[model samples]
Target: MANTFQLEILASDRPFYVGAAEQLVFPTVDGLMGILPGHESMVTIVSPGELKYLVDGEWHYAAISEGFAEVRRDYVLVLGDAIELPEEIDAKRAAEAAERAKERLLHKQSIMQYYHSQAALNRAMNRLKISKRHNHEI
Candidate 1:
């Protein structure tokens, strides 16, 4: 069996990461899902949350927005609406966004609007949490 798999993470604006990874873990609609090399092929809806990948014995993390992932035996592809490394996250901006999303939720709008607001809030909160955890670990 292979020890690593090709991992590619693409954001709407640009390619976020492309390299060989020993393992990968990310959020899905059902919950957290993990992938290993030589895994079965499948596709899944990725939820907004922290994405972790192991490369060269080190783990790297990123915050990813809603997207889809295509998994194959030797490769995986992630296409997210947005993706940001821990260092790239702005805690202050994320916090502000979270507050705005919360306010929008409280106002109560159409179902679509409510869903959007909830998604926004989830993304912002995930970013903030990841940013804080990364900073503290440094």
Candidate 2:
């Protein structure tokens, strides 16, 4: 059996997951990053995208918003702005949010507002894509 490591995924509002995982893969500012048991310790910026983890030989997926991740030799801690199982995502809501964000971007706004809207759009689109992809399996 593959070696396992402790993994704890935390959302801003609540705990998302906590258990042993054989492997973990998540989007990072640079790109997709994978971690396994005894990974080197480091911290990195997590991008808004799909996060996957292997547990008991099964792969689990979740949509996660931007945040940070801390990797240790035997443990990995993820702190995300938001995180949701594919089934938990509401496609309609996500689409609506994406539209709203797009509209906001079209209008004149401060730099901060523009950046916020862009981030919101990215998160909403990512959630929508993940939701759609997993809807058939659910």
Candidate 3:
């Protein structure tokens, strides 16, 4: 599509995506945000959740970690702490991690530990959700 824009998803460990996307949807600390070609330029913090991108009339999904997004008129750059595609996610492993994180939360711990556990739980849940909804791994 002529309206498509460049999208680069940079994971801390590796580059996740580098291509033209017709549309984009990602999580933010405030909420979910969408971007399209010619959108205004801005930067916002990203939250762990399902990142959706439309390319060649197809919507792709990925499990993204906390980071930030830079939006521009002709491009959108996502600098993610981590990123996992559907095929990379293991349903059973994610489920087990989620359960472990939940159990950890049930017990008292330091503030940092609580936050770490929460982050783990959130990532696991997000991965499981995306895997089940998109990959039919339920």
Candidate 4:
């Protein structure tokens, strides 16, 4: 059996997920990172992306925005500005958001608005991508 560790996910208000897992995969600012039990202690910035892990013989996925994780002594904790389950994503809403972002990008009256719109589009796309993949994994 694989070694297990206490895995916790925290957003602004409170803990979002708490459970035991053998491994975790989260999107770091630099790239994706993997964590295993008893792994080296470290902290890194996480991007607006998916976090995947195995727990209780099942895989789980969480979408997060601007977070970081801490690893130490068989425990891994993630603190993010926001987090959500894959199912919580509304496809239609995301699609509409993407469309709006694209429109804003095309009719850009301000540089800041244009770049921010681009980022929003990218984030919406990521959520859609992850949510779709999750349906297939089940």
Candidate 5:
């Protein structure tokens, strides 16, 4: 049997997940990272993207935004600005948001506004992608 480690994912105001996982995959600033039990301990910034893990003989996934994870030998703690399950994403809403962001990007705006719009666009795209994949899964 694979060794299990505690995985605790924290959102802004709530605990998202608290359970045992055999492995974890999260988006880091550098790229995607996978962690296993007895892995090296480290802390890194996580980007907005899909975070997945294997647990209880199945795979679980979450959309995480602007988070960082602390990986330890027997535990991984993730704190994020936002986190949501694929099922929680409303595809229509996300599509609308993506359209809005795209429109905003096409026009002239302050640097901050442009960045914000780009970020929104990225988030919406990721949510849409995750939702699509989830829907196809039986």
Candidate 6:
């Protein structure tokens, strides 16, 4: 049998997801990072991107916004600003949001505002991208 360990994804509001995984991937502020059992302990900031994991030989995906993640020997914990499982994303809604974000940028939003909107657009696009791969109806 393969080694199994607990994985958890949390949002500031609450615990978002908890399960078992053999490997996990998340977008870190520095870049994308992958975690596995016996990974070195560390903490890092997360960026807007897809979080992927392998559970019982099946792959799972989530769209995560900015936050933090911690890795330890037996578990990987993600605390995201926002998180959405593939099944929870609506492609049409995301596309609309992306368009709105582009408009916001074009209208000369502040730097912070631009980053925020850009992050939103990235999150929505990532959600739509990952969700579609799972045979989800767009």
Write out the backbone clash pairs for model 4: none
True-structure Cα RMSD, model 1: 1.8
Off by over 4 Å in 4: 136-138
Error of 5 at 39 (Å): 1.2
Question: For residues 1-138, could you state the per-residue lDDT of candidate 2 as single tens digits?
Answer: 579999999999999999999999999988999999999999999999999999999999999998999999999999999999999998889999999999999999999999999999999999999998888963
lDDT of 3 by residue, 1-138 (tens): 568999999999999999999999999987889998999999999999989999999989999989999999998999999899988899999999999999999999999999999999999999998888877635
Assess every candidate by TM-score: 0.94, 0.95, 0.94, 0.87, 0.94, 0.86
- CA lDDT of every candidate: 0.94, 0.95, 0.93, 0.85, 0.91, 0.83
What C-alpha lDDT, on a 0 to 100 scale, does residue 85 get in candidate 6?
A: 79
The residue-level lDDT of candidate 4 at 64 comes to 82
- Give every collision pair in model 2: none
lDDT of 5 by residue, 16-110 (tens): 99989998999987889999999899999999999999987799998888979999999999999989898988889999999999999999999
List model 4 lDDT by residue over 76-138, tens digit each: 999988787888888778889999898888883788887799889988887788778776653
Best-matching candidate per TM-score: 2
Query: What TM-score quantifies how close candidate 3 is to the native fold?
Result: 0.94
The residue ranges of model 1 lying beyond 4 angstroms of the native Cα positions read: none
List the lowest-lDDT window of 10 residues for candidate 3. Answer: 129-138
Clashes of each: 0, 0, 0, 0, 0, 0
RMSD of each: 1.8, 1.3, 1.2, 2.3, 1.6, 1.9
Model 1 agreement with the true structure over 1-138: per-residue lDDT tens digits:
339999999999999999999999999999999999998999999999999999999999999999999999999999999999999998999999999999999995999999999988988999999999888854
Q: What is residue 102's positional error in candidate 2, in angstroms?
A: 0.9
lDDT of 6 by residue, 1-138 (tens): 488678998977778778888999888767889888899999898888888888889888888888888889998888987788778778789889888877887877689998888777787777778778764455
